[model samples]
Target: MADLELTGAEVLGPEGLHRDGLSFRDGVIVAANGGRRVDLSGYLVLPGIVDLHGDGFERHLAPRRGAMKQLDEGLVAAEAELAANGITTAVLAQFISWEGGLRGFDFAAQVFEAIRDTAPGLVTDLRAQLRFETHLLDFYNELPALLREWHVSYVVFNDHLPHERLAAGRQPRRLVGQALKAGRSPEAHYALMQALHAQNGEVPGALKRLCMELKAAGIRMGSHDDHSAAARADWRTRGVDVAEFPETMAAAEAAHAAGDAVIMGAPNVVRGGSHNGNLSALDLISMGMCDALASDYHYPSPRRAALMLVASGVLDLPAAWRLVSAGPAAVLGLHDRGELTPGQRADLVVLDAETKRVAATFVAGRTSYLSGAIASRFIG
Candidate 1:
């Protein structure tokens, strides 16, 4: 890699933003100023985003109901989008759920394998995270082996079944659509839901055992949409430390109190509230309960959300931006690449100071996305 010194920009450092030039060589930041200088007077150079959880790549992988057959190409295209949005390290959240078709085990395996195969050639650091449905007791025994095979180190447990409705013997909303999507008849799907709900008593034991096994394997575990303190406590007891999108303030507070990493959807912050009337991420952030903001289902939201927080006076630039950068890196247990400090990976994004739009992105000192007037600055 070429040695370069980016000068004349408001470079974000470990403490805050400064006018000091940033230099990097051989894919890592350096303390010495030995590279060719590039003037970036009107830009704000910041740490590249570390996205802990996001499923926005699903559309790129399967644009129109299996429209894209080559999954590797889809991944490459997804990486382009991620780079455009200023993400350097992204965890693509793929589901292994009872829902078949796009979210089935088979589809998830394909996505994971494609990511593993395509990542080496891509500039963006792409990783796979398995969103496992907790009610899939049949797969619990083999899930650890499956995760190893898929090369997935992060796992989030979720249960989307409407247990109250099932216990009431009432059909869930959109049962027929869900059944068709799963390639099962409405009657069969309904029966399946009932059976899954009936075994709820046995789930805790199975889940605890699974969590123990996964913990022993050194895999990171998290719970999704946690709704109560008790629920958070139970997961923590099972060695699940990360809390992804807790649905209530109590749940978030519980996670915070326990020193667990609390991840909120970046879209929730950008929108000022949850789309489904759950807990407000902004509220949690204001209370200092949220540790990081993830892209969730929108790649651009992480950047927009952090900037919005600063614009709204919720936090200063460094504090708000940390939710997307260093905070997420910590959640993922990554010791490098979150800050522009020497010895760290040279992962960064340059944004037009006026519009706050991404002008360029770099990962490992390699240009991943460079456009607009910034391209000329580099070329000239």
Candidate 2:
């Protein structure tokens, strides 16, 4: 039996964009023919967007200041947004910090169980990315357990203490609390913050220990927002393989030079700036410094950013396409995805280039989303 053929779809291959047909069967692509005569003249298609860094689920987890959202329900809503944005393989960032109050390890643990149990049935293929705050030594206990989980694809080390406090004799909690606008019980928040700050305010010897342990257990390591070349060198020494959003161009250039993958936030590109005032992603792209781009917070940013890059002439469409697809997949060592070639996992997304909108999304050769009339008809 022949697989379903999508012909006349605007397909992006190694060559360039062309009218094409792709055949899907048994959850993988068997053939792709840009010259075929099937009728898909209205839609554009590309490899499914691969997001390497994103952590906004904290928004859904705590939607209304103090309100806790149900994990299963939140995940379902997140998937709809991912598919609508052309993300078929999503590495949902889950920050497992040493902090004790809401959005801390305890809360993360529950979400982990829910993610492991529910991800297989979700609309988009889901992977867990544990953003580890290296300064939090107390999280050592969780590392062994978390490394055992099958869905954990990434483990990033971020040390946020410098930004949280000026000088603290009390505990790391004193300044950290201001970042949140009163979420849970004050006492509970106080205790958790104090306990966390006490342990994480120094260089993380425990993290170095856990890194080796987790590496031995087959987990990949990443470094987040490294501010200098020396920091990148330090992460390299710790066996950290991926550099996510390095704050300086020199640091990112060093990572790329040293054979480490350099990641940037797509939002940074689309907005023409960094929310945290870090190195600009467009600047990195233009200098040939960055390797991959993720929807760090907003899911739609990756697709929109890629199109904008091509339109602005920062990169040709093919090269720009790699930032959202092949680049991140290669960075993560996920060869089975990020390409539309035969024998690869049959994940693909259809978009309307005119409107820069997702028209349809597929995962493993099956439809994950079919946009409604408004989306289908939209032309930008």
Candidate 3:
């Protein structure tokens, strides 16, 4: 909580980058300039990234098949990775689905319990997000209690089954592999899929009622991979205001038209297009459709993607950086830390200006990750 002055860096300010540096104390950003100075002449200071949705932590939790028996260790590893990548606040997107393995309800219970227990010692602000598969109708009655127990504030509705193939009476190509991972035979899995698909008629009503209950509980909700304007409208009617990775331009436009935030994958922006041939994030950015960029499946991509946007002349550094920081924070209703302003939380990242690489990350005025060079400056 001691006062610290970060001098000799180009600090990102509301007006844009400033030559004068910043000062902070007591786990909050402060306006006062005089303090114990730490020179960082060749660095660029920006607000720390806030990832709204990311599943990359799944690898740490289960590196190989059934390897992660220790949830605490996996979460610690995940926190380190997030901090190293300049993330200050991260939403761990855990699935509540029938796909089983790491995505099942049982696994989610363990993760939620571990997160609640381990969060106190972590520097990074970790939060849970439930990726609720819409077809898991039976869980509808149980989800409210789970959310309450887990203290989850975010939930996203997803329908990931290959409905087209299933409706055509053709088994999906990866059925066996998926079933094996779920610890069930292909026949059993197929039967489960068929049974779920049969309830597609009842899913809409159940989802509507469930969404209303979640909204009543003050939980933020969103829909995933919306494919059309009509799909967006349907979700909007259910009070699912945020649209996560809308698959088509029409869907994104619809979300924007409704004043809902549109989230796209940071990897999509870095790769210049969706790997699955959906909408292009950069294209959406240029058109002003994408409101925020998430880490998605890769932790490093948020930083890389924002810098890439700057390099591609799509946006200036401050504007592009907002997509990863301020934008996502606002979408998730976190009014505290996304901007480099006085009285805000002192969550920030210092990057080597020449290489655009993260030199240090700070969360709530505490060092979470620091390279040797940056550490030496403070040490000496």
- Candidate achieving the largest lDDT: 1
What is the alpha-carbon lDDT for the whole of candidate 3? 0.93
Over all chains combined, what TM-score does candidate 1 have?
0.98
Model 3 residue 50 CA deviation (Å) reads 0.3
Q: All candidates' TM-scores? A: 0.98, 0.88, 0.98
State the TM-score for model 3. 0.98
lDDT of 3 by residue, 104-206 (tens): 8899999998888888899999999999999999899989998999989899999988899889999988999999999999999998888898899999999
Candidate 2 per-residue lDDT over residues 55-76, each given as its tens digit: 7566766676653557888888
Which candidate, 2 or 3, has the higher lDDT? Answer: 3
Off by over 4 Å in 2: 32-38, 67-69, 163-204, 373-380
Global lDDT of model 1: 0.93
lDDT (Cα atoms) of all candidates against the true structure: 0.93, 0.77, 0.93
Per residue, candidate 1 scores C-alpha lDDT tens digits across 277-314 of 99999999999999999999999999999999999999
Candidate 2 weakest lDDT stretch, 10 residues = 371-380
Worst 10 residues of 3 by lDDT: 26-35
**What TM-score would candidate 2 get against the native?**
0.88
